[model samples]
Target: MKSHYSDAPKAQPILRHTLSVLVDNEPGVLARVVGLFSGRGYNIESLTVSETEHEQHVSRITIVTAGTDQVIEQIRHQLERLVPVHRVTDLTVQGESIERELALVKVAGKGEARVEALRLASAFGARTLDATVTSFVFELTGSSEEIERFLRLMGEVGLVEVSRTGIAAMARGAETI
Candidate 1:
């Protein structure tokens, strides 16, 4: 049997990636963007969108997703083809970047459990947004992993509920995307 001259390397395991997209701040633009992800069956772990440049009528959308290398590339390419999209930057491939997520965690417990929850929140730099005799609401801002860890710990103590603001990511240096 003749050996095939395969130039392709082995497939890599799926990895998490952060993507930043600049698009026109027009009606239906956000929907189109979200549709692209949904239509492709890609799961968006975290998503955040905000107007960044008023003069240019441009908005920035930051999305965190997990997929293999091929999936990531496909996502970037599809986003670029959208009519309202102006630029797509894959922060995961762009080098050092900063990614942050904000979450509000509520805990309701009595006795030592309540005390332990407060102590743990303090250690994680989470601020007490609201507090009552039986419940405490904490506001935390950090990486996704950090929030996950905090939530897990809070569950062990007494987690009532949680709300998150998704992800906001940007490249670290002078280069702006």
Candidate 2:
């Protein structure tokens, strides 16, 4: 029997990517950008945006998502067509970059649990921002995985709440994304 050329839809391997977008810092710009993803059924795992060039009135948005190569390309292309979008850079493919996330983790415990929480936080370099007799609010800044691990440990102790600022990413050197 001759082997047939496969015509089946091959499964696409999902890849995690980080994208940086530069856009005009104007009203409704963020909403429209987010709308594009929501309307298209694209999932954004993490999103963070801020005005990077104050004088130029331009904002930078960092988005972390997982998708197939085709989907990633489509998302980038669509983003470029947005009215206020000036640039779309996939930092994951552009070379070395630095990515970080900030999270405030609240742990509520007492006695041994509290002691363990402090011990774990110390090892992770988590700083206690606020503390009372029965609880502690910790500020942790690191890669997303690091934050996730810390939160998981916190849960074993007394993880109560978590507020994350998402990912803030940039090129390693003089390059801008």
Q: What's the TM-score of every candidate structure?
A: 0.92, 0.95
Runs with alpha carbons beyond 4 Å of true place in candidate 1: 1-9
Against the reference, the lDDT scores of all candidates come to: 0.94, 0.95
Per-residue accuracy of model 1 over 60-131 as CA lDDT, tens digit each: 999999999999999999999999999999999999899999999999999999999999999999999999
Minimum summed lDDT over a 10-residue window in model 2 is located at 1-10
Q: For residues 61-107, what per-residue lDDT tens digits would candidate 2 score against the true structure?
A: 99998899999999999999999999999999899889999999999
Best by TM-score: 2
Q: C-alpha displacement of 68 in model 1, angstroms?
A: 2.0
Model 1 Cα RMSD, 1 decimal: 2.1
TM-score result, candidate 1: 0.92
